[model samples]
Target: MKKVFLLILVISTLAVASQLEIFSSSGEWAFFENPARLLSMNKQGVMGSYQVFSGEGESLGTFLVGLFQTPAPNIAGVLYLKRSTLTESSYRTTIEYDAAFSPEESLNVGAGVSFTMDQEERKEIDLHGGVSGYLFKDVGFGVSVRDFTLWSQKGTYMGGTYLLKLFYDSSRKNRFSYSLVFDQEVLENRIDFTIGSEQKAGLGVSVLSNTKTKENTVKISLGFYATVNNVSVGFGTFIISSPVSSDPFSEYYYTQGTGIKFAVRW
Candidate 1:
């Protein structure tokens, strides 16, 4: 019982931490993360993703669906719905709308709004915005502000989350990116690193590290994605290692959990 409780606690903490940072570098989900990336899409498509995390008899599941389109040459938009289940009777749903505008070839700006409702009917509204542009032909920088509380029926007005990102693309085929994220309410800092290819079938990996605590928590994710005939599919898995405790006679103990994801876009 103690082990199970500990596992649940760790997983829950990790889940909340994950929500505080931008994880996607680029893709259909990147718009959901940073909004400015909406302009990066070249075609209209719908995407769906499902993910589950499990450890020590406790599990959490999330489902997301997104629709993206470019109605004009310089504008792109996306709408997405995300639902997560913490327990059989406990769940939360979020719906968001985001749009990006590129006035020039090298500059993009975006804004978004979202509403979230939990099982208890508690509702919250959040605002998001971002700017991204190329510094050189193959290097870019981005800044985003997320989770700015517009209103909350039962929650306090926490300040917004901020992220600064830098990325380099070689021939627009492969990318390496890094982001520094700050959560104002929690006073926490996290760093994310990712490397991947955007063409054909490719493998990618991402690492996230919490820099606020001495015993940092690290999450590593690996995935493979392929595109064919305007359809894309992805398979991914992630492992999280969190420091649990330290004993007088032994080194620090760590707890680990794993999760899997499946996503498709067409």
Candidate 2:
């Protein structure tokens, strides 16, 4: 049918609008928080992170402004901005706003909107919602969904994504934690899995693998941080390796990058 053909064409044209692989903020576990984590009043702050792709030729930068304390005890909000550049020819920018609510200690829910623009002047909008909560003793689960629409001169393209995360908190008072995250890019039929562990004393590690790609690329990330005068400073690095590519004309098979972040409460 005409509708089926249009849908397929739209998905193919907007596949390039997929999420970017940027370094997490402060710690590798930050990726788990980016999509759905609710904000607590005690944790409001401003932070910025920058990362390079493949050690060169690509880079991403992000800034977060959070409002954790308000007249209402159950509401919080955040603003996120991100920019990325690839090989000097392609660039993208994203801006999003999220509002979160906690009805009780065991439940959290949020909704957000995001807008993105690329080098070709194409634009896309995303409407997302998420839910997360502690299910059992020290164990938690989260789920998030995103509906995206791309506006082009030819027609409009629609896509969707969903993510699931499971985490364990060993000590609620800033101790040790571990989590597993899975992301599904529904429209594109791609999936990513990640595992990460962190310590409040400022050390963490993470690993990510893509299931739908033949390139066999794996990303490993490490991070450490410390606090001084109520300010937190973090340093992190990422390494990407792929064993299947050897041709000189192929993309970089091995790449390493470093990033740093600083945050303070006010």
Candidate 3:
């Protein structure tokens, strides 16, 4: 089988890391790659992250540094880096950053760039943008477009992703919240969906999946701002065998990342 660049080691790393969300699966982190809600705490913050992914019982390790902020009460920014290894074989590294603005406390717009390396060679760049807010009490929606590379989306690669979320918070103070995110490739693959709920002190749950193939991945996440007075943590697993099994012929393999997170605020 001819080695497809998409299956290269660097690409697999991005795939597993896909589970992390760095924020949420639902697009709450839409302003950037993390999620819309992740930006909910737009104030300046930082965190440490780690993730492990197992494909066909092969375990890979990933370590990360994540940080974000709201330059102003309505402005936000985020930065992160991931160092990964597959069985102690140095695989890939990624660096990314995003900045945004919230107008009238109901809208947000942002963009981001990611630099990925495999064998220390530039591998991929991810770009994104989204806006979110409520139409009425307990009702909100968010839409996002990601400038993904062709390999990430397939040959039809529009190089984009779109996400929409509907949520209702028991508390309206932006203190506690929950939302359902339906994200799709915009023009590729299946419908990728996510369901998540979160609270003020720092804790949450999420389930991500594919619509057509019936493949499902579930994850449990927690954030404790208390380290900087809060804590952040997360875990997740995906059912890759159901529809599209791991490429047994996959020579150019790549892996993604996800895991525990710790951050401090100044």
Candidate 4:
């Protein structure tokens, strides 16, 4: 009887640890990040970004390269290659292809696919789609389906995830933008909300507040972006509180992360 009890306890411990692992390895991008913004593309170029996090004398990093193409007038496509690494032994690489179309002046639609692979030879493919439209002159709304079709290496089909976002921009002034975003991950049964804003000059300020299913905790992030002579750069930092756990060996606590991005366009 005691042995059976020990087995169950061990399993519980592992499960908690796994959850923490996923939490700690989240990407550096903001919760409000949406690739559908490319639907309004007016320029073509390449961009590269690198972000790093430091904690407990260890560092994790991500690097990305993006290519933008305008095959014809009013149509755009983006291809991305990204690599994320916690250590030499733990890493993931992904390739993504996305395209956008503007059927008229006020409506935009997009679709994408992402292929990801890890060190353990596990593979996943995620299908994505989205739509955005202007309600009035300056107010707009969008809905995105991420992982709409999830497939694994063994040809297994997983579930889907979705996100909804509403935004407003001052087209006349081109100086301010605000957004509300909600995300749902069906497989993990997790939901999150984010409210974000940006005030633009040659230098821009961006801020966001996010709340998830966790109890009594909220995550906040502050960021900045700047553009000069066709080159753009951005940086951000976030604060996250670890989920509650009773296990003594759990390395759960509050943590912080930072990210940086850069791009050049003609």
TM-score of 2: 0.65
Cα lDDT of candidate 2 equals 0.49
lDDT pick, better of 3 and 4: 4
lDDT leaderboard ranking: 1, 4, 2, 3
lDDT of the candidates, in the order given:
0.62, 0.49, 0.48, 0.51
Highest TM-score scorer: 1
lDDT of 4 at 262: 49
Question: Which stretches of candidate 4 lie above 4 Å from their native place?
Answer: 1-32, 53-59, 154-161, 172-214, 243-254
After superposing candidate 1, which stretches have Cα over 4 Å from the reference? 1-23, 184-214, 243-266
In terms of TM-score, which candidate is stronger, 1 or 2?
1
Worst 10 residues of 1 by lDDT: 245-254
Clashes of 2: 0
Ranking by TM-score: 1, 4, 2, 3
RMSD of each: 10.1, 12.6, 10.4, 14.2
Worst 10 residues of 2 by lDDT: 185-194
lDDT of 3 at 14: 41
Candidate with top lDDT is 1
| TM-score for each candidate, following the candidate numbering | 0.75, 0.65, 0.61, 0.67
- Writing each residue's lDDT as its tens digit, candidate 3 over 106-195 gives 766666777767654646666766777777766566666654553432224433456555555444523334444444411112222223
Model 1 deviation from native, Cα RMSD in Å: 10.1
Off by over 4 Å in 2: 1-36, 41-44, 55-71, 150-161, 173-215, 243-254
* Candidate 2 per-residue C-alpha lDDT over 1-266 given as tens digits, one digit per residue, 9 for 90 to 100: 65445334433433322212322322322422543454443355554555544533434333233323333667666666766666555666777777777877789787878888877877777777778778887777767765444343325555445556565655443334444444331111222222333223333444444444533455555555655543555566656554222311112333665655544554
Q: Is candidate 2 or candidate 3 better by TM-score?
A: 2
